[model samples]
Structure formats: C-alpha cells, structure tokens
Target: MSGDRGAVELEGVTKRFGSMVAVDSVNLSVKPGEFLSLLGPSGCGKTTTLRMLAGFEQPDSGFIRISGEYVQGVPPYKRDVNTVFQHYALFPHMTVAENVAYGLRQKGVPKSEIAAKVAEALDMVQMSKLAERKPRQMSGGQQQRVAVARALVNRPSVLLLDEPLGALDRKLREEMQIELKLLQSRLGITFIFVTHDQEEAMSMSDRIAIMLDGHIEQLGEPETVYEHPSSAFVAGFIGRNNFWQGVATEHGIRADDGTEFVASRPEEDVPNGQPALAAVRPECINLSAERPADSNNVTAGVVAGVSHFGDVLQYVVSVKDRDLLVLTPRAHAARFQQDDNVFCHWSADDVYLFSARQADIVMTDGDEEIHDN
Candidate 1:
C-alpha cells in the first residue's frame, strides 16, 4: 500500500464454473485516478470480473498485473486492494472510529500509529464529527461514508466497489454518488466500481465497459458510449432506446412499417438488402407541433402519452405504427394532449445504425407495412 496506488491490467482473463462460462476472455486497463465502471444486467459477469480483480476467484487463463507487477499467485490480503460492498458490513457494536481501526489492529500496527491514521481517514470522508458514534446511531448514508473511510484508510492502490449504494433511498443515493465521485478525485486513486444501474454508471463513471453474456460489448467515455453505441445490444442496454427493423439499401433503410429514412453506415457492414436495426435516443428525437418542412427522417405521429418530469417532458408518439419516446425540455413544454397529431424529426447523425442481431424483435403498433422509397 505504500507504493504507487494505481494502474491495473487484465489480459485475456476467463473464468468458468462447471460447464458454464461465467467470464469470457476479457482485456482491460485502468489508469491512475480513473473512475471506471463495469456495467451490465445481473449475471452478465460484471461481479465476476470484480472478484477476479480482488483475487477472490482465480482466472482459468490469462494474467493480471497491479502497478506494473504481476500478481498471479497473490491473495486478497497480500494485494494492495480493498472492497466496499452494497451492505456496509460494519460492526454493530463498534464505534465508527473503532470500526475503521479494526483493519489496522488486525495487521498488528502500533496503537499510536493506528489512532493517528484512523483520525486522518475519518476526516477525509467528512465523518470525523461522528467518529465516536455507533453504527446504529448514524443514518445509512453516514454509515456508508464510514465504510468508505475504512477502505480509504488502508490507502490501497485500487478500490473495488460492488453496488455500494444499492440499499439507500433515491435522494440519499444520488447525494452519495456525488460525494463518492468527489472523494475519488480528491484522493486521486483508481476506483473500479461495479453496478447494474445504468444511470448510476453513466453519471459516475469516467469510462464504462458494457458487458453482455460474459463479453465486453463496448468500452469508452460515457457520452461516446451513449451517443454512438457500437452494437444493438449495447445500444439497448446502455440507455432507453426505440428500435425499428429494416433492410439496408444504398439510399438508406426501409423499415418494416413502410417508413423510408436515410442513414449513415459503412457499406461493407450494411450490405444491400441485409437486415438492419435503427435506434435513436429519447433526447435526440424532437417533437414539433406542426408538419416539418423537410422529408428526410421526418414523419407524422400522434402523441400517445405525456409524462411530466421535473425539468423535462417525456412524450410517447405513435409513428408508423411504432411507439417512439421523445424528450421535450420543461421550458418549451406546451399543452399537448394524447391523440394530438405531431411531427417527429431527427438528423441522420442522431440515428444509430447497427446490424440486426438475433434479438431484433421490434415492438410495433400494427399501423402499416414497411416501404422502401
């Protein structure tokens, strides 16, 4: 823990249980002071990846390195890493400072040094005020902060968290996200966070690695991964998406609902007459009160539902027999009711083009058949 407390590399790591593969061959590198999240649905191998990093499970193949040193035979206690789980796992009878000092005590550190380090760690998480309080005396958020302090106190090279805030209420959970992010920056330590909450990963991560069926689907900055998803699975999993099945053509694509729209995708990838998938984010779609001037990627629809969020409005419009989600800003939210005819328009760039995978089942309204214009 006294050396450079960052830099991790995973080379073609794979883990299997019995005949089932829990983790496929995976490669990743985390830089110092970076906040990286392993995001996916449950049983997608994200938690397994975290366990491998923490030395809880040995990889069936490949190698792992920490701070430029190979740790193939290293154990959890020997490695400069610590984990904070969703359950705080605090000692119910121990005071905050005592709980934080337990790790040091087990290491047989001197009494004077343990007291000094414990005080310093509690201060870092802004919890020094409640150092003497028991776990039952503090709120959930505060207790979680103490857990964080315990992990940071060790000053590990890498900190691993597995859904650390899953138990908190909505408002408190959001507040903790901000606090944890700020703490990571202030300490400048690498944080490897694992979570299934898409919004949590999007808001807190510097880079997100999306996993599906034990494979890494996409890895990039949050905006890059969100705005330009590489595959249909990643697009549908990372955020809310509306999809339509179509056939690729040189001009564009012809949806099964008879809506012809222009799209930008590689020729080699989108072979002519091959099946394709079209995806657009809710925020990228625009809702207009009247008919739009142009015809490129523009169509008419009726507002099927309107949901009022605090600062934004979510509109579901039925276009070409498909329910499309659109986001309207609060300031521009006009009185629009269900069944009102409206225009849905978007730029060609906003539309994501991906090859139609096996899970290309489209939810439609049974309005019209696809047409190629």
Candidate 2:
C-alpha cells in the first residue's frame, strides 16, 4: 500500500461469532516484506484472522494496519492486499491470460496495458508459455500457478495465502513450497500465509505465530521456536519427541518411573510439585550397547520399533518407565534389531521441560496437532 516495509499489525484483535469467540484479544506485528504464517490446528482462528485481514470478515475489537495505514473499514476491493486461496478458483471459461487480466479489465485499464501486465504476471510465475491454456486443461500445479499470477497481477503490497498448495499431491506440494517462496522473495512482497500444516509453515515463513484456542501460543523464528519452545503445547506441537509424564522438582523433573531427568535447564523455574512433561527428539537420543561414559540422562531399553526413512533410521525404544525415540543416521555402520536390549543416552542440552497444561491432549484419540518442530 505504501512504501516497502510491508508492515502488518494487529492490536488487541478480537473476532466473535454469536456466543463463540473465534479470535481472542491477540497482538501481532509483521515486518515489511516478511513472510509470516498463522499456524495452528483447525478451529484455532487462523482462517478467521486471515479473513479479517482480507476484509471479508471484521474484527469485533482491534486495529489492523497495512503498510502503516489503518484499514479498519476498508473493503477487500479497496485494500491493497491480494488473496491466493487454497482452491485455485479460476474462471472455467477464460484462458490463464484472460483470468489474470480480469481484475485489470474490471478496473478498466487500457487494452494494450492489460495485455502487457498479464504477460508480465504470467512470466513472473513461470507460466507464460501456458498463458493461452484454460484452467481445466492444466494440472493442479499449473492451475495454481495461474491463480498466483492472477493475485500478483494486482501488484498488491501484501499477499494473503490461505493454504495455496493444499490441493496438490505430496511431491508437488513440496515443490510448490520452494517455488512459491522464491516468487515471494523475488517480488519482495509481504506475505501472510495461513495453514494447519506445520511443515509448510516452517518451510516458508520468516516467523510463525503458533495459535491455539483463539490465541497465539508462541511466535518466533522457526529455529528459535523449534529449539526453545516456551510452553508444553509448543514442545509437543513443533517436533517429534518422546514425552514423559513427570513431577517438577527443584533440581530436575522426576518421570513417572521415578527416573530423574536433569536437563541443561532447571525445573525450579517451573511450579514445584506440579505435573510436568519432559521431551527429547529422536535424533538427540544416543543408542549404544552400554551406557555412554559421562552421560547425564541414560537408559536401558529394548528396541520396540525401527523404520527406515532414507537418510535416517527411526527407532522407538521402550525403557523401564518411558518410551524413548532414537534417530540414527543411515550412514552409521552400527545397527540394532527389534527387541534388542540397548542403552539410550542423551545429553541434558537436548531435553525440554514443560508444565502439564494440556491434560486434555492425553485424552484425545487423534494426532491433529501439527508439531511444527
């Protein structure tokens, strides 16, 4: 809208639907030209928040600013933002070029100018060669490219992407992730991506706002949030970890089996005597025939399960009180078989501690959380 910082801000943003509060009072800020993601499970208000930004929905109480200008009442058509939806909602009767030019035509741009801009937008998405093709004639990926070109053709300062790659196959989704990021960078536009997919958000966003229950649970750069989760929800949501139910002590945390896990961090800062959760990723666990010398957290466990993931081998090991996960590099020459007795050792630095704030998660049956780390 104005200048390049592509700044987007939300202060005390609250949205309500009848008796239900879809988005609680939330605060967020995005730097100009930054790729930020609203990441969480369904019903977490990510889509609602995005719709608010695009002016399709209004917040009950909040201020939204784009490019440093307040846009509380500005409608979608007047706002300098373009949306690329999950479905490639293209016009069936129009070719890619015509679809892209539709917006400019509605604005009544000169015929010559519209043609030039349409060609440029298609070229920007590497879809110029297919400009004459209709949406039904193209693959999912190609159709989505046309959608992207249509959104970009408007030259909006901010791009709002609502799961733009959700319809593609796995490999194609991954490829589009990289490609879309490159396009965002090359165009230097501010992008706000919404998704329930953790990996997609992690791969593309400069910063991720992890949301839950109508609030943002954590917001940070991908690596920072992954390595230093601020809450139990984050530690369990971000990455695969072996979780242990425990009680907090001043020195460390005591697992249910009475095994004390001393992390590089302390449990004293956590409420003493409260239920706690300790987690460590599979790759952080060390596997050996015997306990590693000078290891702080080591356990004897049986290989409960093992699976090959190309470059890495993932193992689920059952210790006396806790089930630990161990990830071994495929390059490692040593191998273990299922049911083999082994010692799993991990450094304190690899451990994360959290309060048992989500007892409900233990009762849930399905794995709906993204676990972005």
Off by over 4 Å in 2: 1-5, 266-268, 362-373
lDDT: worst 10-residue window of model 2: 363-372
- Candidate 1 matches the true fold with a TM-score of 0.92
* lDDT values for all models: 0.84, 0.84
lDDT of 1 by residue, 331-368 (tens): 98565789999988887777777667534422222222
| Best model number under TM-score | 2
Cα lDDT of model 1 overall? Answer: 0.84
User: Estimated TM-score per prediction?
Assistant: 0.92, 0.94
Each candidate: how many clashes? Answer: 4, 5
Which runs in model 1 stand beyond 4 Å of their true positions? Answer: 1-5, 265-268, 333-335, 358-373
